[model samples]
Target: MGLSKRNRWRTLVTASVVFSLVVMATGIALANITLWMHANPTFVSGTEKLISNFEKENPQIKVELVVFPYPDLAKKVLTGILTGDVPDVYQGWGMWFIPYIRTGKVSPVPSWVTTAEELEEKFQPSSLGAYYYKGKYYGISAETNFWRGGLHVNLDILEQAGLTIPETWAEIISSGKKLTKRDSDGYIIRAGLTWINQDNSNSQFLAGIMQNGGNYWDEQGYVKLNTPEAVKSLSFYRDLVLKHEITSLTIDMSAEVHEVYFKRLAAMLIRPGWVVSIIKAQYPDLRSAFVALPSIGPEPPYYPAETGWGYQVPAAASHKEEAWKFVKFATLDKGASRAWLTEAFLLPALKSLEDDPELLEAEKLVKVAFSQLKYGRYVGDMGSRERFTQIIFNISQEVFTQKTVVKDAVAKMEKEINEMLKEYR
Candidate 1:
């Protein structure tokens, strides 16, 4: 009897193990498909809602979102790509995608994208034009921003100086001189105008170049940094300190330039449109106005430097089709795009949503941002963009700090940029 009972116990244990294995296999086969996505954390809540809605509608597809701080997301994604553990979809900038594209790590937008002309018609020219690389589309614009180079003026300060908003570079210099203040020892007590002394100095320099009817690159993709137009642009920027004395390196190297403006130590600043929101939020009582950067030359077409971010799918994505579906749903769907606009205050990339009543009702600064979209020109979308910008920034700093002559500075920049472009050739 004892032997029989032991035999029965062994039989029961073996049967239970077999049943568990069968159940596990079935569960694996029936599991929901998960799509991994990464993006900046700014609008995670809205994105979560969109994901939830998508899952409810599709029922079989699940989306897993990983949010990272904007500054760190690129590095995180690049590491993931190396480890072959990348998300199915991720956020990227126009220039940031170039390295990935060169490695064949990024897939072009699905064949459904059809002709390039259709894409231009479907999205805003500047926003959609950004993602076109080497005759193919690799991504879609998630948000369009056109506030590259604008003059942010403290209206009260200008009024106190008995000046009106200036429309030309000469007028700005004239006004800036009067608005500038000095101490008894000839020290700069207040700056009349300032530029943010950060990476954005590249955009400011580019705006000057573009307004002077020059571009960073020619049709053959050569660096034009030392051209006559570029020299004029860089010289004008240098003279704002060394010649006109309207601004000083002491002010630029001090606290953040916007902070200087907020403290009423500066009468005007040349920066992007987003500064309007910052000023409004931080100093509501301070009167301010926004205008296009004054023309550096007499020209019919003065372009504003344009920059934006977008979404792309990895070529190695395990769920390319499903990822494309999500990308379409998130960026092309009216509700999803509307959520981005209403919640995150991003400018709409879709042409259809440009005139939406809801967007029109956004902050005055946002409306002003939309108005400038027509003048937007792509900036820093080439390969090695960050390195190029750093080089330009350093050159500008040398001029600003009186360490190098403008002629010498542009020549050095031209040589370095040409060497940098050789890899592309």
Candidate 2:
């Protein structure tokens, strides 16, 4: 009786093991992977289509997408990090992932997932570099934006004034003078140039410094803001209002709030290339053009290209393999990639998509933006982007208000940034 019982137990254990292997082979045991993204209707639509196709191709896998509001998305991600409950995949701004990467919870893209040759041949260097650190790449770029050197022109306003698109800074000022309109009280009824907010101001400042042959980052990636170039950049913006008189302090032409650019209250707005998408979607009927800002110095114009946002798999994820599969599919699959680019109104990070004839022909503005990518200088690899941006914003406001002169403001900026970098050093 004891021998019979032993045989039966062995048979039962063997059968159970076989059944588990069969389930694994059929992909029945692991079928779902989770993804997190910020809320945007166009983005959500694009993702939904991509997921649908991904699921069709891999019938055994299902994707569960979790959308959060823009402001709350980072908070939710932080909570997930603390609790070790991260989604299988997370899509976020490239720079925003820097902190998480240092925590060691973000998985580096495996060699099997993407070969080095494909990585180099397919994607933009700056776009891919956003997720690179210490010789490891952590994510794939979904979208990119060159925030420097784009001068957005309201063609209707330009046409009414009988002026063509201004190429150089000298032309910008001269044309701005002609475009400015004043009321009976000498208050600005229309602004010839609109700076809008700190975001645009900071971008223009970086461009200005580069134009004047100055760099915000040195060879060792340390902050270098206390220079003549920095002061000159800040002064230029100040002069736009006080010295040049093209921009007015009272004109509330904020892009988000007033949209004075679209309303024809502003003739020209200095903005990033990606803003063209917003213009196309929101004001399709409004005639507009985006031209590269001509070189201010003898050297070529340098643009700050940031890897906007992309997808990554978490180290703590339950289904990392499935998650990576989705990430690869989302970023590399041609049809899905095209759909995402079109729906999201994003600039292409892939080399193949850069010259998509249909996309270029349909959106002439995008073509102009793409042509400017040759001058792109990748600035997304640094961890100090937010802190540096804040300092620039603060100094720009002070200078514009005349509470602080350009020299003092640049000195303050350099001091604050270097002080912040001490911790990293």
Candidate 3:
């Protein structure tokens, strides 16, 4: 009798615990519970607001966003792949995720959602190429970028000098010489234009290379940094800084170039369309106008396409079916796509919204960006993009700093690229 009584008590306690767990889960899901997710460093001030709006629309799914820094995203993602803890979805640089793709680690997207033919028509060829590899598609382009680096001219400075927007680089160079001013102690108080550091974080100098009809990669897939065309491109800018008063190197002397435009220290400088927010925020005093990147030579048509990042899904995604819904909503939603482009300050890489009113208005500044997609070349990036960029960055610096001959830079670049390609190819 004593043993039977103890068994009943144990059974009663177990049933009570199981009942509580079920009720708790039901309440959490039915009432409100966040779906844990992660995102890249792509959004600006209104990221939370956007998520809140998304939640209001889809009350069943609450997104808890963890935005990673751009520089560190690669390492974090690599770890997640190893540990099998990646979030639902995340954004990545367009070309940088090439290596992760080779392991069959990304979710295999079904053809019905975004058929291959439809994808081709939706995005520009170059944007489509960014996500395609070996008959498989790992991701889709979320934004478009190009290489029309232009001068963001401070209107206040132009007005002060009684000047007008310049049409060509020659005019800008001459005007720069006139606009530059120095203190008696020989420190430049301001420059007509500033040469912001052109290494990795920004590919500003590629505009010159493109204008001259020279490319970073040669026909045989070798680095071509020291080519005659490349030398001329670098020489043009070096001369401006080292010899002429047309421009100044930004690392040491300039204020945040974005902020300087408003402060009037720089009449014009080479930068992307995306910096407008920072410029508007930090220097509200400045009025500005943009002109196409100054032409380099008379004959060759060279406008490098803007290089934008992309969003990708991991092969190890635990809930790929659910994850793709988020990708579709975030990257392809007609309403969301337009809003994201406006909020994130980028060009739409999707096709459905070409006539989208909101995207049409905000992205008007980058109307010339798509033309770059035609002549744009991304080396080794369809699979090994990071290596491709690193090699170019190193070679570019070598040429700019006068450390290595173009021939030597090209040779070194070939070795680096081939090594990186060996894994993906």
TM-score of each: 0.79, 0.86, 0.78
* Candidate closest to the true structure, highest TM-score: 2
lDDT at 52 for candidate 1? 79
Which residue runs does candidate 2 get wrong by more than 4 Å? 1-30, 252-258, 380-384
What's the CA error at residue 302 for candidate 1, in Å?
Answer: 3.3
How do the residues 1-425 of candidate 1 rate in per-residue lDDT, one tens digit apiece?
Answer: 35598898999999988766765554322123333334434356556877777765554466777777666877777776667778888766656676766667787888664356766776777676556778998888766765455778889989987889887778889998999999999988888898757555776667678878787777777777877788888887888888999996788678878788888888888766556656655689989887767567555335543446677888778877777777787778777777765554567778888877766676455465566666667664455877787888888888888899888998898888778878776
- Superposed Cα deviation of residue 372, candidate 3 (Å): 5.7
**2 or 3, greater by TM-score:** 2
Cα shift from native, residue 315, model 3 (Å):
2.4
Model 2 alpha-carbon miss at residue 281, Å = 2.7
**lDDT of every model, 2 decimals:** 0.72, 0.77, 0.61
TM-score of 1: 0.79
Model 3 residue 109 CA deviation (Å) reads 2.7
For candidate 3, what is the lDDT? 0.61
